[model samples]
Target: MTLASLDRISPRKGRLSHTTVFWMVFAVIMALLVIAPFVLPVFWLKFLTEILIWGLLAMSSDLLLGYTGLISFGHSVFFGLGMYGAAGALLHSHPANLWLAILCGLAGAGGAALFVAYFSTRLRDVYFAITTLIFAQIFYVIIFTWTSVTGGENGLIFSRPHFAIPFLVDFKFDRYTMHWFVLALVAGSYVLLRRITRSPFGMVLQSIRENEARTRAIGYPVDRYKIVAVMLSGLFAGLAGVLYAVQNEFAAPDFVFFITSGDTIIFNVMGGIGTLVGPIVGAGFFQLLRELLSRLFGDQFPYLIPVGMVFIVMIIFLPQGLMGWARRWLNQ
Candidate 1:
C-alpha cells in the first residue's frame, strides 16, 4: 500500500469505543493481575513477568518494522545491552534502586544505538537487516570477549538492584514483588506506547513504512526520522532487557544471541505486529505453549509446538495476527 493510502486507511478502523465494554475488559485484566498472586502458584507470576518483558521487546520491533518498514535482525543487542547494564549497575553500584538500574540500562542501550545508527542508517531494506545482524554479533563478541568486565561467558548474577543505605544495608527483593512491579511497569509502557502510536510521529513512521521514497521526496528527512525511530525502539528494548535480567536474576551472552532477535520477530508476528495488544497476547500464548510442551515431551517438543501453532495461525488467518481476529470480532 502507498503511504498516503496507509495514512488515510482509517486509523480508527478497529477502535471500538463502547465505554462500558472497554472499562470492563480493562477492569478484568487488572483484577486478574491483583488476585493472581494469591490465587495462582508462585512461579506463574515469574512466567507472567517474562511475558511482559518479551511483549515490550516485541512492541519495540513492531515500531521499527511495522511502522517504519525497517526489519531489523539485531534487536538482541539492545535487549542484551539493557540486561548487562542493569546487572552491572546492581552489582557495581553502592546505592541501587530498581528505578536507577532501569534508567542506566536504557542509557546504555541508547548509547549503543547511537553508535549502531551511524552506520546502519546508510543502508535500506535487506541491507538494513544485514547491518543490524552484524551489530548484534559485535555486541555478542563484546560480552564474550570482555569476560573480566561482563563476566565473559558466565555473565553476572545478583539478587537485586544494589542499594547500600545508611541504616538498612541488607534488604533483598522478593520474587513476587519484583514480578508485580515489573507488571505495573509493563502496563504503563503499554499505555504510553499506545498513545505514541496514535500521535503524529506514529503516523509519520507508518507513512514511511508504506512508502519511504515518497515521504522523502515530500521533504521529510527520512533518514533522520528512521534514526529517531530506531533510538526509541532501542530505549524500550533496553527496558525489557533490564526487566528480563532482574526477573531471572541472571544476565549472560545469550541475551544478545541471534535467536533472541529471531524470537522477538516471532512474537511480533505471532501477536499481530501493528496491533497494540498483539504482543502481550502473543507472548502469553507462546509461553503457555512452551510450558505445556516441555512438560509433555521434556525438551524435544520445544520449537515444534510454537512453530506448529504458527503454521495453524498463518494457514487460516493469512495476514491477520491473533489481535486482528479479536478486533474483527469486537467490531462485529
Candidate 2:
C-alpha cells in the first residue's frame, strides 16, 4: 500500500477511541484510589504512593520516547531537579510556601528541559539518548557535589508542609493526607495528558514520531514541536519529583542518578509504551514484584533475576509490553 493510501486508512481526526466504557473504567479506578488509603496497610499505602510518583516519571518519559520518537536516557534529571527545587524552597527559602515550592520545581525542570532539548533535538536515535544521559550525569554530579544546599552525601531532610489552599480544602502532608494528595495529582495528571494526547497537537506529535522528515516536509516545525513535548514531559516529571520529595520528607542526590532514569525506562517499557495508563500499572506491578521478591529471597538482588526474566519474557512473547498486549487482545 502507498503512504497516501495508508494515511487515508488511518484517520487522525477524532476523539481518542469513542469508547465510553473505557473512560468509565478509569473513573471507577479513580474512585477506588480515593478510598484505597483507608483500607490499605501503612506499608502498602506508602508503596503505592511511590508507584504513583514513579508512574508519573514513566509517563513523562513515554511522552518523549513513545509519542515524540525521542529516546532520552537521562530524563530523571528533571525529577531530581524537582526534588531539590521543592526542598530548597521549603528548607532554605520559604518554609510555608507549598505552592511556590511546587512551582519552583516545575519551572526549574521545565527550564532545564528547554536547555537540554535545544542541543539534544539536533541528534537522533542512539546519539540523542547518549547526549541526554551525559547531561543527566552532569546534573547528578552537580547535585552530589553541591554540599552547601544539598548536604551532598547526607541528603536534605525537611518537614512536610501544612499549606492552606484558599477556597479549597486545606490539609497537612501527613502520611494519610499525603497519600490522597499524590493520588489526586496522579489522576489529574493522567487525565490532562489523556486529553492532550487526543488533541490535534498530540496527533501532530504522533505524526512526527511516525515520520519526522515527512512531517517537516509537510510544513510542520518538527524541532519546535519536539521541544514543547520535552518541556511538558519535564514539567510532569518535576511534579512527580515534588510528590516524591514530600512522600519521603527528604531530597537525595540519588533521585537524579542514572539508575533512577533507567528505572523509569523499565517502568515505561514493561507497562507498554505509548499508553499512559500502562506506565502506572507497570510501576505498581514492578513495586509489588520487588516487594514480593525481597520477601522471598530476603534481599533486593534476587529481584533482579525476576525482573530480567520478566523483561526477557515480554520481549519474546509481548514486545509491546502489558498494555500493548492487552490492547491487541481486546481488539482481537
Candidate 3:
C-alpha cells in the first residue's frame, strides 16, 4: 500500500491509548539502568554503553526515516563528523574539556546537516538517498586523507576528558561514570525526541512524509520542514557520535563510512521503523547478539551469520519489530 493509504488508517480511539503505559515501561528501564552499574560486570557495562550510543544513532536516523519518511543513506556523516569534531577539541585543548568538545562536535554536525539538507532535500526517495550517500563517502575520503586533523586512517585517540565543572560535580570519564552518563543521556534524548515527534511541527513532518504533494498543496513549505527534520536528526546523531568517541576513546574514518549508515538502517528496520523506542531496543538486541555469537562460535564461525539469522527471524516473525508488535498487542 502507498504511504498515503497507510497514513489514513487511524487506531481505534480509547483511554487505553494513553501514554501512561509507555511511561511505566520507561520508568522500569530507567530503574534497571540505575541498578546496572552495581549488577553488571565492568566489561559488560562498557558494551551496554556502546549499545546506548548506537541506539541514539538509530533513534536519530528514525527521526528522518521513520517520522519524516526521508531515508538518508549517508546519515553517518553527522555521526563521524561529530566524533572527529569532538575528538579534535579534546586533543587540542590543554586542560581537557568535555563540554567544549561536545559542543564543538554538535555544532559541526548540525552545520553540516543544514548544508547537506539544503541541497539534498530537493530530491526524493532513491535520488535523495544516493545524494546523501555520495556526500557521506566524500566525507569519509576527506577524513581518511586529513592525517593532521583526523589522524588519517589511524584515527585520533585521546583519553576521555574530565567534566570541567569544578564547583559542583567532579565527573570523570571512567567506565563506571561513563556508563551512567550514557544511560542518563539516552533517557534525556528519548524524552526530547518523543516531545518533538508529538509536537504540531512533527505532525506536519509526518504529513509531508506520508504525502509531500498533498502536504504542499495544503500550504506547508515541504522542503523547509524536511530540512528542519533532517537537522534535528543530525543533532542527535552528532550527540551519539560524541558519546561514542568518549566511550571508545578514539575516532576513525570508519565512523563516517557507508557501513555505519547501513548498520543504522538495519537497526531501524529491525527495531520497527516509526517507533522511536524500537530503534534503541533493536540496537541493544543486535549488539548483544553479536557479542554472544562471537564468543560462542569463536573466530571460526562468523558472528554475522547468527546476527543475520536473528534479523531474518525478526523480519519473518515480527515484521513490524518488537516494540511495534508489543504496542499492537497491548492496544488490542
What does candidate 2's lDDT look like per residue over 1-332, in tens digits?
Answer: 23322322365643255346668888898888878889999988898789999999999888888778888876789998899898888886544577877988898898889888888887888898899999999988988998987899778899887766878867776767888889888889998987788688998988998898999999999889988998999999999999898778899998899888888888888898888888887788788888888887887466788878987887789777788787767656
Candidate 2 global CA lDDT score: 0.83
**Tens-digit per-residue lDDT, 1-332, candidate 3:** 33322422344443254456667878998898878878998888888888899999999999998888888876789999889889989998978689888998999899889988998999999988999999899989999998987889999999989866868887676777888888888889999998898788988988988899999999999999989988999999999999999888899898899889999998998888887888988898888888788788786778787788888888999888887787667646
In model 2, residue pairs whose N, Cα or C atoms come closer than 3 Å (at least 3 residues apart or on different chains), thus clashing, are none
- Please count the clashing residue pairs in each candidate, in the order shown: 3, 0, 0
By TM-score, how accurate is candidate 3?
0.93
In terms of TM-score, the best-performing candidate is: 3
* Candidates, ranked, lDDT: 3, 2, 1
Q: What is the C-alpha lDDT profile of model 1 across 1-332, one tens digit per residue?
A: 32323433465653465445666887799778866777767788777778878888888888887778888876899999999889888887666667667888999888887778778977899999999999999889989899889999999998776333557664556766676777787788877886777788888888888788898898889888888888888888899999998888889998798889888877777777787578677778778877887887777665775667765767477456777666666556
For residue 168, what is the lDDT in candidate 1? 67
Model 2, residue 256: C-alpha shift (Å): 0.6
- CA lDDT, every model vs. true structure: 0.79, 0.83, 0.86
Per-candidate TM-score against the hidden true structure: 0.88, 0.93, 0.93
RMSD of 1: 3.5
Q: After superposition, how far is residue 260 of candidate 1 from its true place, in Å?
A: 0.4
Number of the top candidate by lDDT? Answer: 3
